[model samples]
Target: MAVIYLVPPVSYTCPNNTTCCDDPTFDTSVFKRTIATEFHLICDKSWLQSFFQTLFQSGVMAGSLMFGIASDRYGRRPAVIVAVMLELCTGIIAAFMTGYWSFTFVRMITGAATGGIMVVTFVLLMEFIGTDKRSMFSAIFHVPFAMGHMSLPLFAYFYRDYVQFQFAISVANVIVLIYICLLPESPRWLLAMNKVNEVVTILTKVAIINKMPTDTIRQAVEQYHINYHVSSIPKGSVADLFRTSNLRRNIVVMSFTWFACSFSFFGMAQYVSYLTGDIFLNVFASGAVCFCACLVAIPMLTFMKRKKAVAICNATCGVCLLIIAFIPDGILGMVFACLGMLLNFLVFIIIYLYCTEMFPTVVRNAALGFSSMMARVGSMIAPFVVALKPHGQWCAPVLFGVLPLISAVLCLMLPETKDIRLMTTLEEGEAIGQSSRKIGTK
Candidate 1:
């Protein structure tokens, strides 16, 4: 999250600042050259900034899909350890690289590592905790990410004169490596891999810490031994994601959600300067407010069902973005921006949780990786739309509104997973997701 908040500004600031500021003498071509060299590290002619972002993010997403397969095949703990180490090394190398190409390649590798880390960490934490408490814990995990997001702009404001922000981000990630080393492996993963001895040992430790009966824990584990054997390998191609079968609907709905939500989210974020009367102060204030709103989402997740909660948030976000589109450049603009920030905070909560819930264990992380790739496609292209010549003050917000509106409609087609158990196979997910809607149980 820290890197997510930092990297965009660092890469695009040269361009964003120049575009917005009414400096007639400033060369737009210089903005393109500086941003491309720094962001892509590709000094090659014909490289566009958006194209580089797409290529970089697609590689990261593919790497994430592979990591998910590795984790599911091997174990979550090993996968996370390897990913974090890679991230730390790549980030440090990125900080010290001499030329644009070297740094860009290093950052691409770093993105890949970070993608794996994100998926494994989330899956591990959810599997480590009990079902009743999973949503609560998952929501808690997002708070630190929100804090990191809010802290990034301040870092950027202070670090503008130096290019050492990359080094600082790398140092912070190294600290993450320390934390990862100390954390325990997921007991669920141990059980799934048929490592009963390890699972028993971990459960015993957990029972002792919680002051629970070891016999009771063992009994629970014994009752859970129904081996509904499914295919270990993912059958078919990436095109299977779009077939008229179970995987297709999930893919289509998820793809739409990913594209729409991301477009709106980044669209609003990119125009933070224009949304409010005083760009600097408003950006700071809105960031803090959004952070608080993220905290509110935790409790909401606990009390409310996931489907209805996400629907409400999406509807609210769409409305807010629409409102922002119409407001003039004054106090009304600030009001609309604040409303949009609140909605964005809520929409983000849904995105994080819903993306994870929408697939089975076999392809769960892979599904997220694919959806995230699509989202990055939206993110890469969204800025350019607002930057297009015909677009003016209202263009960003209008596009933002349009995107979420589509998301709201597509979301209605998805089945709720609030009460459904985490599925372990495609067949199970397809049956449950389809039947859950028919049975009218969210």
Candidate 2:
């Protein structure tokens, strides 16, 4: 599609003393169909392509805030179901869209739905799993995302038509929507809402399924209620994240880290198109590297302190990007680029685990939502940064390299969260950071 959109320049004869070339025009003879060709999204209107992509991130930003609040107020299961339904409907609508503006509108809505599903699902999984197993499960959870990225090129290869590809992706949501019906609401959420009877009922059923003795399950639930005092903690608001001194600093640093991580990761991914090679091959290579990074991340998260691991990942990623900026464009540069992407991908996995552990359960969803919203800002701007490649090849890579390095340094200010109990209250969370600092001083 990109190749077709990049129409070849044609020569025109000059009548008098000078020779001139006509404006490049789409060549339908080579490739007759594509959104670009169909809409004449070429020449001066090419910026619209980037604009269309940006709108999706904008939607994601909006959706994160919307569904984050909704999940906290309603429940994770309901929020996730709504998001899936939105994606299913909007994706189909986007496929049949004939006008460019209409397609862009649907895509923006689709992006929001995608964001809602992702954030809520992450919180749901973290809430259900044991703290010790979270890092491993988080890594496992990301496998499907990496697989989705890797599968896109294969889908495009087999079904070259844009409409067909859209339908193929959209239809999978139907299966998800059906599956969502069977999922139970988060027990932690029920407990937080002071719905003890509901929590007991759910835990009893879970115990029955696992064949655990009913007495043991009852003892565990009684112990949890006494230890955490879950009923006393008030429902959290978004403002609670900023109400205290330590939390304010934590939010500031983590939000910036999210922005940096996302900006660099997406910037590198988008720039693959500009690399000198088959676009499909470049995309596949990038996805493969990211998948490998996910595998490597499993043990890293299991053994290493989350803060140190993230700092190291960010620094190494920065170095790789720097090398790519200097090396001549070819296999070597592509190698460095892929390496940078791999390390950045590791950083992404570690950060998700870190963020999940950092905040208390009360505001966990809201904090994650705010952080993701900051990330969308980074992602939104990434395309424009990549677009700067026409002026200088190194411009985008240098920007991407520098941000993560800054993030690496900033990471040192955040506390290590590995092996600690997930905080259930704001005061407890603030104390953890303070205690870590006091220990550091010794």
Q: Which candidate is the best by TM-score?
A: 2
lDDT string, candidate 2, 251-297, tens digits: 88898988998899888888876787876678788888888988998
Model 1 lDDT, full chain set: 0.64
- lDDT (Cα, 0-100) at 335 in candidate 2: 89
Q: By how many angstroms RMSD does model 1 differ from the true structure?
A: 5.4
Q: What lDDT tens digits, residue by residue, belong to model 1 across residues 216-302? A: 766666555345443242432344455546667877777777777766665566566444344345566667767777678777877
Cα TM-score per model: 0.81, 0.91
What C-alpha lDDT values do all the predictions have?
0.64, 0.80
Candidate 2 stretches with Cα past 4 Å from truth are 1-24, 27-32, 437-442
TM-score of 1: 0.81
